[model samples]
Target chain A: MLARDDQPTPPLKRTPLHALHVARGGKMVPFAGYDMPVQFATGVLKEHLHTRAAAGLFDVSHMGQIVLRPKSGTLADAAGALERLVPQDILALAPHRQRYAQFTNDQGGILDDLMVSNFADHLFLVVNAACKAEDEAHLRAALSDTCEIEVLADRALLALQGPQAEAVLSRFCAEAASLRFMDSKPLPVMGLDCFVSRSGYTGEDGFEISVPASAAEQLATALLDQAEVLPIGLGARDSLRLEAGLCLYGHDIDTSTTPVEASLAWSIQKSRRHGGARPGGFAGAEVILDQLDHGAPRSRVGLKPEGRAPVREGAQLYAEADAADPIGQVSSGGFGPSVGGPVAMGYLPAAIAARGGVVFAEVRGQRLPMKIGSPTFVSPSYQR
Target chain B: MTTLFTPDHEWIRVEGDIATIGVTDYAQSQLGDVVFVELPKIGRQLKKAEAAAVVESVKAASDVYAPITGEVLEVNETLQTDPAQVNTDAGGAAWFFKLKIADKAELEGLMDEAAYAAHTA
Candidate 1:
């Protein structure tokens, strides 16, 4: 749920360059808690294709950024407390590294998926824009009395993504490209101080820069001047991430899905497994450990719909001949600009998923042939 | 040829008993980039303002309503391969189908250009 909004939305969020977007005639819509552009005057296909070729700038400022501090010094203290709830091994992370993980419930279902960065001074975290409040409340409830969580409201996040992304961003933070995938550093981009993380949702190479909200527009405009940059909207952002095989919280990975069933076992620390030093004590650890030992009943899989027709989210999937007995349903689906066809990711029987065969997605009334493929429809181009 | 529009944003061109049906530019724009179009089979019977076809955009899935009751005599097969025709030339080549008017009186209920402008407003 969003904070109370008593007034009508202003078409779209103004960003710092609401003027530029309006000048360019962007198509805006309400997303998360902000009015964001779904496409520019050109359209979605063009914006998507542009990101594949040049670079696309995304305003992800609505995403929440939080700083965690241990009352004392060691991050291990914080990680130990966090491990009781989240699936990632925070303590195992070396300094300046980040990991993609989720907060799981007692039933092993994911409450939210987020990025956690182990900083030299603080444990930095970023969560989805829509669930910021709920995530914070959950974190506070789980935090030990000694740990303190602070919201970074003054910061704004931007993602510059594509093949030429590094070349353009290099001009701002030359050393940024040198940082390996999932590594972050405090860097100055166009004289704007920010945390430059070698990360992005798009499978393409990119960076998510967190800067003071005050300097966001200046930095965005500066990047757009590079000729290769175009202001991307939430529409392309969504399609790009879907093509990358990344899960969108609420849509793909929700409170009903667990790290194990979502095929995110890698995020679980080895220590939490039955063989590790800590057998199973985390919340829902019993169920998670049982799934680990005996395998989950269902697992997330990538579904490639035949032809250009998309089998979108919530569309039912059934056995090839039998229409009534549904085996699974689509969680996320769309037209992948790179693949030049329709693609979807959904959950199905783990046994069916293990073999990697064909299935049928019931789009409308016709059954479309679907091949089970790897999650990333295109090869991920992260600058590792 | 009078351009008549249904409340659902479908527009029909009437010339005698044959009425041509297609979604309006406004409706297409709201649906975002057109990706797929589910064209109804020929000879399908349609009621006045009934769903005659499906227009699937990248952002959403919507049904094209019949502006005037009739029997669907022909559907635009071109939409199967190039749905963007609707976004690019909605009133021209993107016409969804042609219907044999069951009763000409149904066309009177649809809005004219001036009335459509007000209805959309």
Candidate 2:
């Protein structure tokens, strides 16, 4: 809960496309210390459905972009150094490939989830906006001797997502259609040098473009001009990712939840596990490896509310309707426009985490029924 | 018959000690899309300013308070299944409930159409 203080709050930072958002009838709100559009004139429901059927352009400039180059002049050294912090097998990451990773604390709890792309000579990373400053400091403190960290503060990130994404982006950058899922490289887009990655959070075939801040508006305007593209806001982005079963940094995975417990063990490569080439070297390896070998006490699972009422985040979960103690709590819950009903994700005791198992969520002093199911509510569409 | 509005954006149509209540068009617009609504039970007594109903949007939930003391005579059950009506026809067919006025004098505090427009402005 946020503190209700009388002190004046700091002024919110604006993205390069702030003016364009305001001009497009975006409803601005404060998010991650930035003034961002929560929804546009099209509203959340339409914007969400539009992204699934067509293409939606989003401005994600608030996220941090960093370039990590090895001081020893070898990408392998940088990858090896990074492997010490994350559980993923970064040493085997091929060129122009991107992998999802998380920064785990000493206790195995997740600090933040990020995407690491192997560029030609350096590693390009995109971290959450809320954790960027701390992530930068953590990197400098841990691997400064092995790598040179360069924070790209003058760049803007844009996501062109959905089924028609490749079609729309190909009009400007013909190379966009050729890149498969998780492929990343430097491509010339509309006369501007950009780092294009064929990956997105919407579970759709899309591309995330990292462009210069000075040319962000021009690129965004050109994309929006396409008949298949519409300007989406943070509201639809959240719903899209939620339905796609993607975890939100602070909400789904936090300082108290480990990757294994969060159902993210798939991201931890076999080489990082016990008896592999490199095993038990990363932070909290003992705890994580134990869970991998055996099982976690509790696990994250998707929830489908039996009724129309949404069981929002922080709602308690119960094993029985009249149970005095809650078995778990919802981390992220909302109306899934694509699902045509309310959907949620939360942790449940492993004993009761079976698929199709019944649980109860207390909403407004009443226990509502929910069904446990796979985390992926919507099937992902990747070029691969 | 007389129509009055509350500062909280509720509208009350009074006729012979009976009041039909719902949210204003301005309120519906501000709420964006209505996904769910919970109405009061019939025959329940409500005091002035008490929470009588709940309207939930895709993002948040809001309370619709009783404008004046009354007893719930009837509720619009259609809202339970078709909540989007609150967004499309909020001031007309989307009336939430009907009340039997307990004190006609309580209606004096509500604003007329012109006064309510100025308040919203």
Worst 10 residues of 2 chain A by lDDT: A1-10
DockQ of each: 0.40, 0.42
Window of ten residues with lowest summed lDDT in model 2 chain B: B54-63
What is the DockQ of the complex in model 2? Answer: 0.42
How do the predictions measure up, each by TM-score?
A: 0.93, 0.97
Q: Where is model 1 more than 4 Å wrong at Cα?
A: A1-24, A277-281
In lDDT terms, which candidate is top?
2
lDDT of each: 0.83, 0.92
Candidate RMSDs in order: 3.3, 2.1
Query: lDDT tens digits, residues A45-81, model 1?
Result: 7788899888999888888998888878778887777
After TM-score superposition, the amount by which residue A253's alpha carbon in candidate 2 deviates from its true location, in angstroms, is 1.1
Cα deviation of A125 in candidate 1 (Å)?
0.3
